[model samples]
Target chain A: MDTISDTLGRFGGVYLLPLALGAVAFILMGAPSSWVTLTIAGLAMGMMVFLMASGLSLVFGLMDVLNFGHSAFISFGAFVAASILAGLSGWLEGGWFLASAALALALLGSIAFGLAAGLFFETVIIRPVYRDHLRQILITMGALIVSEQLILAIWGGTPFTVARPTFLEGAWIIGDVSIEIYRVFAFVLGLSVFVGLMLLLNRTRIGLLIRAGVENREMVESLGFKINRLFIGVFMLGSALAALGGAMWAGYETLITPALGGEMMIVVFIVVIIGGLGSIEGTLLGAIIVGLTANYVGFLAPKLALASNMILMMAILMWRPSGLKPAVK
Target chain B: MNVLLSIRDMKTSIGQYHVLHGVTFDVREGGVFVLLGRNGAGKTTTLRSIMGLWQPSPASITFKGQNIAGMTTADIARLGIAYVPENMGIFGGLTVQENLILATTKGRFDQIRLRRIYELFPALEQFWSKQAWALSGGQKQMLAVARAIIEPRDLILVDEPTKGLAPSIVAAMGEAFREIALTTTILLVEQNFNFARSLGRDMAVIDDGHVVHRGTMADFAADSDLQGKLLGLSA
Candidate 1:
């Protein structure tokens, strides 16, 4: 058993699962252009999901806090960004540079608001329930409900339409396939965040400490580094990332409501679980699988689209109980 | 000799059960001080209380003349003390080098100190890049001690370093502890009588969360009746 596991673990590039699934879809559909379009869309959706789930995964891994109310940050970010963009409609209608700047400002506003909310949530709500999974789940879920209601009170029950910048609208034509420009942007941004996070975790001292803490927090503390402060920082960072994902997702859907984050909670949880609870690389792999499976299944059988993620998660868990690439400390 | 650490009536309770009841012992500077006890005799708890892993109150733990009874583990560690728990506390998923790197306060490796550690435990350098979990039992114990001494420390609290090890490894560990005692004060908890007697300059026998005996190791070793009465050893 050890030899088998060692061999399995030694295989480095384990991300080909999604590509293999895409190949299956391509063969079944027998339409190269349509397959290309769906694959890119799947990748874009995966990237957005990853932005939201990676934070939760890190928090859970490091602090062992199961934050059920992570969706609140997403909803807050979506509404905050949407509101800012709505106010900047004039600048968005101007030249490309002005529109791009306005979009950038909206993202900044959303992220800032998200950071504040995250700080509040972590200090006031999450701090008291550290290491208590049942309480954390109960309290965070309650907080989620209350925040959703607050969103309803502030934004009303109607869904707000989100407009993409003129420069980001329409699809880029490449041969027979045309990909949405917003999706391309989401992919690039998501990939950049992933790369940045990898560097931060692998190349930096804090990252080493965080990883060590996940393995043995008491030891890390005994080594003269306060793990609580690191945990608080992680909590805030996770919340900010969730919000950023929410803002991007709002633009992708072109619709925002109180349920924006709540609805994505299932997908976020599925991705995090499928990617092992704390492994960033695992989360990315899980997200891509979920995105690809959903799109491919949705195309093949629209009725199975919503259930595809659940089925995939169950199957992966059965194969690897700890998820793929369970983050090594 | 100056007293490096002095614990006075240290009391600690884990949840509703009181573990340490007025456990008091003084560790002198520049030698190994052994805390001996049978299983569930609160030797580990006493060491933990000193390291500030458990909250100790209505107790005074003075290290370098500063009361550290109520301090956090990190704060206590910053005062130049390191702890090696009974489990060795090795981050199994991390490489040997990474494990050692995490122990340093500056987050940068001190090449000179690291070289000293490597010279002390040559096996650490041999398995530097390997994951800690893959190491043998004796190697893991060495890694744990190596981690504690990664940075210059004034005092080290080691819990059962020779637990579950072969006799040869235990003898080697005793030799290492004696070498380390030349520069730093050590407070060790051990179940193995032979290993404990080899390096312990001062000894305290703890039973039921209280210190039952305290004296020089030479005096303690000379009394077989006291060892049988306090530690259930019929040497």
Candidate 2:
């Protein structure tokens, strides 16, 4: 057993899970083009999931706040961005520059709303319940319900049609493989965000505080830092990222509802849990694994689509109870 | 020497159970002031109260002529007081370099002080880039102390830093504390009689949560009877 684990540990252990899963799935479904399409689609979905999960993980890991309303940020971001895209419909139909600009504006609108809403949420809703997990869960869950109803009241309970810009509208067909341009864009954007997040966490002072803060907030406080102040910044950043993710997801589906966040919430949670709370690298790895598994399972056994992530989460937890890459305390 | 910190009737309670009951002592400026106590004698709680890690501050807890009781832990820390908890509470996920770097103001280290730390704990220099969790027990304790003295602070509250170390490591830690005391005063809560005797100048004995005795360490060390009675130690 030791030798098996030793061999696995040498070859990246849990980090190689996505590749391992993909390899197994490839043999199971023997068509290369189909595999390629599924792989791309899964990766794109994973990136969006990553954006949503990263912040929630940090907020929970650092502040010890179990914010169930985190998905509310995702929902609001989607609706706000969807509204912006609808308003910028003209720009989205023009040249690449105009289309990209419109997309950027929509994302920015989500970000702005996220920051504002995050601050308000943290101060009004989250501040009163720090360290009370039960209260945080209850309050944030309550806030999520209120947000859903607000979305329902404003946008109505109807499925809102999202406008995709012309630049991101079509797919590039390569022989038997048909890849959506938006999926590639999503993959690139998510990768960029991942790179940026890595740099921010590893190369900056704020990142240092954050990493240390996750391990022990009291220790951070003893080092002369008001960790609560840092918590506010982190909460805002997480909300912004979640909002950006929501905007991307809205575009990915090209249709959304008040229940968009509620539905995505479960997936976001699974990704975060699989990644380990408070670990960015873990979250990314988990997201990709989940993304790949969900897509593969969706194709192979349509019945297991909803249960795939739950199974993956359970298997990983049974192997490593602390998640794949927990922040060592 | 002048008193660096004065705690008058300070009390702390954790969730309906009071841990510190009117604990009072003075940590004078310079030298090691060891708070000698047996297990469960509220030594850790007193240090925590001074660090403001716990609430329920009583009458007064003053540091450097300023009343610091009821202040936030960060605010108290900013007043030039560093604490090394009983757990050697360093961030295990962070690199050794990152751990030391975080303790400094704006992550900028004073070259002279940084050199001093490297000289004191040469092992830390060797494992500069290693994550703190990877460090051995002695190394982690050293890193914790290194973090406290990374930048010059006026006072350091160390809670049982030598708790689980081998004698060799404890001796090395004692030597480090001796060197460190020359610049910054340390309020060391220790159960080790010999270790406390070797380094402490002023000392106090807390039984439950109150200081039962306060005097020069020389006097305390001379009285084996007092040591046996107060700390259950024989000469």
Candidate 3:
């Protein structure tokens, strides 16, 4: 009995708590179908949120600059992918080969767009406003408005459909349940990206410099590294990641509209705040928890979907002011 | 001694608050030059200005006979100068080994250099795998110094090394700085008069951003009146 108590005391409140809650949710809502199907959906949505939140959290962690314009980058990527994929039918007829080719183009195009936007924001807007928080907020908010308007002008007000490739069509059956291939594809893409990003940060000199910058930007600058160049690099990388998620979501959801970004802005912030500021792992865990909770609640009581996320965040904040895993002192 | 870095009438302002008022000092090549002052007297500011952390007014600085007044910190650092800020400024998340790796940009990991640094401070080798935050205050200070010296630099600027450290660590830091001064020109800002005097070199007393006194450590030690006037505390 003592050993049982000790084990619970040791790891119960850690990630185990969240895992248990998520499992219970799976068993309840997605029961008749294999819990694994619901789990996969939960995991994919969780990673999608993670992909979006990690970059946002990193920028906030390093620069202390709250970027409200981040959602715009995500929406922009989705719109870009949808428009390119939608337009490809005019130039090429067959679906699979053309879809594959168009996806490749969309990936490259969105990254380029994101990189340019990041570089431009760093130089023209963010650099000057580093000294003033109020000015930064106002300027970035203005930029956000401009981006949203640009999205509307380019893609129009109509919701555009993002067609799934023929290869990703139908569902994979495991036991009594069936899982859509598109969600699984999104899960693979998101997790693969998360893994790739982890490698980039851990196994590179640039990553070391970035970690240093997170601790002390002044020290990094004084250590013979071009601060401007590093800042630009980080911003562009962050923007590109956000854009990739956007593009993937567009394909996964089969629709892209400008308002999608504005709607997601609040949820992204909630994930970042609960994930412990600047921690990559915290972001991942927080994103998954939030995703599964929202998904399950939306399944159970459709009216309580949004409120459930808000309540979960509020509970975490009330309990842990510094977040689940605060910055190491 | 030859002059390696010269600060001539350097003036700087941190967000409209003028901290350095035309401070001028020369760091002689291969010498331990200490800037002595009380808190808020702008000694740290002088070191920062020289490192190009703060852009002092143009036409007031030169390094190795070249104008460096408007250069960025990174550009100045590339010219073989390193700075250790007021706070140790060690990245808390990184291990000691990773910190050392990040400091090495020359592409030669230089095992000999690492061994030499370890020889100077053996405490580092034991804590190589530990995150910097987990180390004691003294270890962090040693790690900061080790980081600056592991890579080659013509001159190194250290601000308040002995601050918030044990007396034993301060003594060890003094000896380490002494050994490093043999290879690199050092311009250090120190408030600990005993530690500064123990270093045994030229000393500049900065009061309100002006160099009011510049002489040997012995000369300053002999004159209590000047020390009191400049430092505002009896030694």
Candidate 4:
């Protein structure tokens, strides 16, 4: 018990920073007495990071492809979901079942949009740049510009709003803490997707094949595994997950715009770098750390949210060049 | 006898420096065919070209009598040719059991055959649950070989099996190869002359991206001078 207390004492301040910031946010934001609301908010953002970081880390870790245009997919997904919500101006909150159906449609629609976007990016832009780092950077940068322009042209620079279901709009109060329903729903949704992704990667045969691809892509191909198809599948999945995150962000902020994706992309990169590339578990840990850091730092100075991630990434890299997890196979 | 794999005048270039310069070989049905060469002699490149990991100079590569040159590696693999690379490439993160399961993609889970494989390398059974990265060099080689033979294939291309392995493990590996050769066709690339000689089927000595000598291993073993001139070492 003494040892436990000593250990806790050493690490106790670290934990309290986030809790204290959250407590302050609960009071200052005038979000009446539900600490759970802020907890759910943290969880939601953490999950959003999970969806983006997992794909970024996987591709960067396994394929050695530093996808500079990953944010373009996120922006594209948000625009797609927002457009759908815009189209559904009249029908979002009819009932729980219909609201759920709308959300599902948006989710799947965003996934399909992600797939098409990924396919075009990989086949047209990224394929020619394989194993060429400089060319990959140049081409993907061009892709990022082109995608950003496309989003601007289609959705414009203005933010778009999507309605929340009536069931998910209110708040639940528990003693000193009042929690928002949408944030709770978003947290559950994020965790469920994370768990599902883990199962897909760990428990399936294709997962083994994918892991093999991560370790040695050429060998996987040499072993009679279709490496091109694997690359496409990985690219598609990564984009879909990123888009899913974008969709969730659209719901949380109740507003979607092309700008948010580019903003979030920087944080995603920091998470991938700090958590270690190619490790699913590492990405999860990294996401939570970055989420909490942003929340904690944002409480003191809202602008530090951006700088803190960069500082954290630099610190982790200075201590360990290969990121938190060594990517050597 | 049916021809399992044939490479004719294949040339492969990686970034302006050509690796395979008009190299050619053939593997007839059911025997251990060896690709012998000194270091950097394009022996591994030849195997990779056949498996489509490298682009072969357009030529007739007929496996099971169908032209397969220039095909994708995975498609060629699905056509029943398994490649074991020079570095003993087993998925390091996966366990021996998981590795075997992943390799056996036809849904043919042969526990008895797997047990037989474990019997060949008892150390493997002992470390079945351990991640393959933690395995010793010999155990990794055994796992690589086991992964190759787990799924049924018409031809298996093994690159440098006995490299960097202990003597006892090499002996065990030799025995395993002998057992595999009883029912399967193998095309091997080896610098270990004695190990290649022990297989005693047929040998092709490659030098500087070309096959310099092709004959029965018995004849090559008998001729020490030819071995010295081609491989720079006689065993």
Candidate 5:
């Protein structure tokens, strides 16, 4: 019985479900070009969401800390990257080499600020609430509010436009399917990160310790490893990932606002919940589902785009109470 | 025999409930010291306190003459002590090999020690890449023991190696424990009187967070009436 369920779960959850969802949308639309465009857009969006959700899952899985204020790092990254890019707009319009260099500098700046913010958040805001889920939620929510206000104070309460680097401004027109270069970039970046994380987690000694620590913290400690320090490092890494996602997202949307992070929080939470709290693979799957659902539904029924993800989350939860791939259980 | 670890009047509290009260015992070097107690007799808590999982107040837990009462669990483990909790504390998500790999300080198993562990718990090697969650209960227990002895530690605290197992597995576990006792000192908490009596060199009967009896296991085994009075056993 256990083997049967395990086999079915692996088959259904990993492959059939995603393919079936995409096929349904393709059949409904009946336009191959439109389906291809939407699929690419959805995959790109999914990748970006995966970037943000992966960190939350890791921190929650390993440390059991529910950081509602994680979006603060996202907002900081967006704003920081936006400012750097805006300041270097002249260099961004120069040759391909200069344009790429400017973009790299902006991304690095965003990651640096994100790291600093994550260090401070984990040390000052999160350290006190370890193992206390209720306190973690309450305090992190409060921290989120304060962080949003701080962003408002620093960047002013107005929306700002973000321009893609000149090299990434156009689309690849293949017959009838138009693929935005930026979306492809986002997809490649997200895929690289996902692969990198997988290798880091599966191939390294620290990764083995992290997985073990997640399963049994005391056992890891009893083996003479400082799990607390490992958790702190994980938290920081998660924050950095969120920032990377935020920077990419700002360019994808071509806009930044004080509320950028706060707004993305809803989508991020939905992805994390749907993906299972700590499972990275689940997060990726969930993000893609959400991305596809949003684009497909938005095209079919403009009014339902906002509620589609919520409905999807509810349906997935009903089918799998612990989310699609619960890391703990 | 030289005393390797000594716990004197150790007191511990879990939340508002004080669990361990003035518990005292000594573990002689290179011998099996069985802590015999009934359920909730603070046997597990005593082992946890020794591993520094629970902070004991107004107490002295000395290991090799150093006071290590309130140290962190990792710090105590660094002093060459390993713990196998009652639940086996196996990482169910990880493979058997991965679990053992994580237990080593260098994150890689020593080939010599690995071979020795495999010789003792051959089932672990058979399921090297299998997730620990899939292992049977007895196999999991064996893996837990294998992890503790992966490195040559000075001392090991094992909680209930045969808590729930078939008679055959329990006998096998007893033999394994006996073999392990040849190399390192062990502080074991056990509810199985027969199994404990078979392998234990020294024994202590604890009740309600206090040590009621302390002597050689042979002496305890010889006195059936004392065993009945303390452990409610005729054996």
Candidate 6:
């Protein structure tokens, strides 16, 4: 097992996983244009999931908090962004600058809500259940259910259609392949966020504290920094990211419902688990693999597509129990 | 000499398991104060209690004339008390430089202190950018100790610093501790009697979560019969 894993590492390491998956899919599909389209879809989908999963992974890794309510941020973000876009529907029909302003406003709304809601959730819902896994799970799950019900009360049970601005409504066609502009946009947004996070984690003092806290919370506290305060900051940041992901996802899907949070929760968890809890890089890797697998399987074997993520998770866990890239302590 | 840290009837419990019943000792303000005992004799628990890692109420643990029991670990630490856990508590994912950077109050290093640390543990300076997990055991221990003293600390609680170290490395650690003691008081919880005795100014023996003997290291070393009675064959 070690030899196989070591060999895998030697061959460009785990980061090559998405590309490898894409290669296999390309070979299996045997249609260059279709493969190109699916691969782009996969990368875009992976980025959105990365946004959602990264924060949850950090919360799980550092604070040891099993936040089931995390998906609530995703759900609320979607609803909030969707509502704002619908309110500003006139802007979508206008020029690129106006459309972009509307989109930016909606995103800002989601991010703001995420930050505020996250603070409330961390202090009220999570702080009380620290270090107790059972309670953490139960309380967070309870929060998720309540948020879903709250969404129903506010947005109603009907599926709401999201209005994309004219700039993001069409696709870029080159030769036989067609790439949706929205997917490209999602991919860019996710990449930008990922890069920003990397810079923060690697270049900043707070980032150093966060990385160290993820590895050893006790040691971090022993070094004289209040970890609970850091916990609140991270929880807020994670919540905000999840919200941003949800907002983007709403735009991608074009339609969303109250079940949006519950639906995305499973994939978010799979990403966190397979990527290794508490590692941002691991979360991104896991998300890409999941995205590629889902898109490929959905086209190749539509019936088996839903179970693909679960199967992949089991396979990965059986091979490496702690995960592909666990934060080493 | 002033009592830098005074622990009176400090008891700690892990879940339903009561680890420390009533451990009491005082660390004077200077040099190494060794707390030695056999394995599972609650020495580590006593140190952990002082750091407020385990909060057992109704116990008085005073540090620098302030009672710190039941306070958060970070609060105790912010009061200039650093702790080096038995596991070293090195952030394996972080670089050696990053690990040291986390220990500083303002995330800025004093050049003189940093130079002194590099002099004491040259390996840390050599692997400044290397991730801590890749470091050897001795180097990791050096990083742990180095982290504890990265900034000026009033008192440092160290647990078993010489465990699993090579003989030469242990001697080097002894030398480092001796030099550190000139500036900061250290309450060391160790099982290695020879290493503990070499640098310890005052010493205490704990058995079943209670102090059995307390005096100067010289007096404890002179009585082999007392050492046998307290520490058994290991002494």
Which prediction has the highest DockQ against the true structure? 6
Lowest lDDT 10-residue stretch of candidate 4 chain B:
B100-109
lDDT of 4 at A273: 82
- After TM-score superposition, what is the CA distance of residue A62 in candidate 4 from its true location, in Å? 4.5
Q: Report the lDDT tens digits of candidate 5 across residue range A205-306.
A: 988877777677888888888887998888888998899899999999887887888888899999889888777888888899888898999998889999
For each candidate, how many residue pairs have backbone atoms clashing (under 3 Å)?
A: 0, 0, 1, 6, 0, 0
Estimate every model's Cα lDDT from 0 to 1.
0.89, 0.92, 0.81, 0.80, 0.89, 0.92
Residue B43 lDDT in candidate 1 = 90
Q: Give candidate 6's whole-model lDDT.
A: 0.92
Per-residue CA lDDT of model 2 for A93-212, tens digit only, reads: 888899889999999999999999999999999999997888988999999999999999999988999998887878999999999999999999999999998999999999999999
Worst 10 residues of 6 chain A by lDDT: A320-329
What does candidate 3's lDDT look like per residue over B1-235, in tens digits? 7888888898999998999888887778986889998888898888888888887989898899989888888888889888888788798988998877777785356898899888888989999999899989899999888889888899888999999999888889998999999889888888888888888588888888888888888899889888888887775
Which residue pairs come into collision in candidate 2? Answer: none
List where candidate 1 sits over 4 angstroms from the true fold.
Answer: A1-13
Better of 1 and 5 by lDDT: 1
TM-score of each: 0.96, 0.98, 0.93, 0.89, 0.97, 0.98
* Residues forming the 10-long window of minimal summed lDDT in candidate 5 chain B: B51-60
- Candidate 4 lDDT for residue A219: 73
In model 3 chain B, where is the ten-residue run with the lowest total lDDT?
Answer: B100-109
Model 2 ranges off by over 4 Å: none
TM-score ranking from best to worst? Answer: 2, 6, 5, 1, 3, 4
- TM-score (second chain) of model 1: 0.97
**Reference contacts preserved by each model:** 0.81, 0.91, 0.79, 0.68, 0.87, 0.98
Q: What is the lDDT of residue B227 in candidate 1?
A: 93
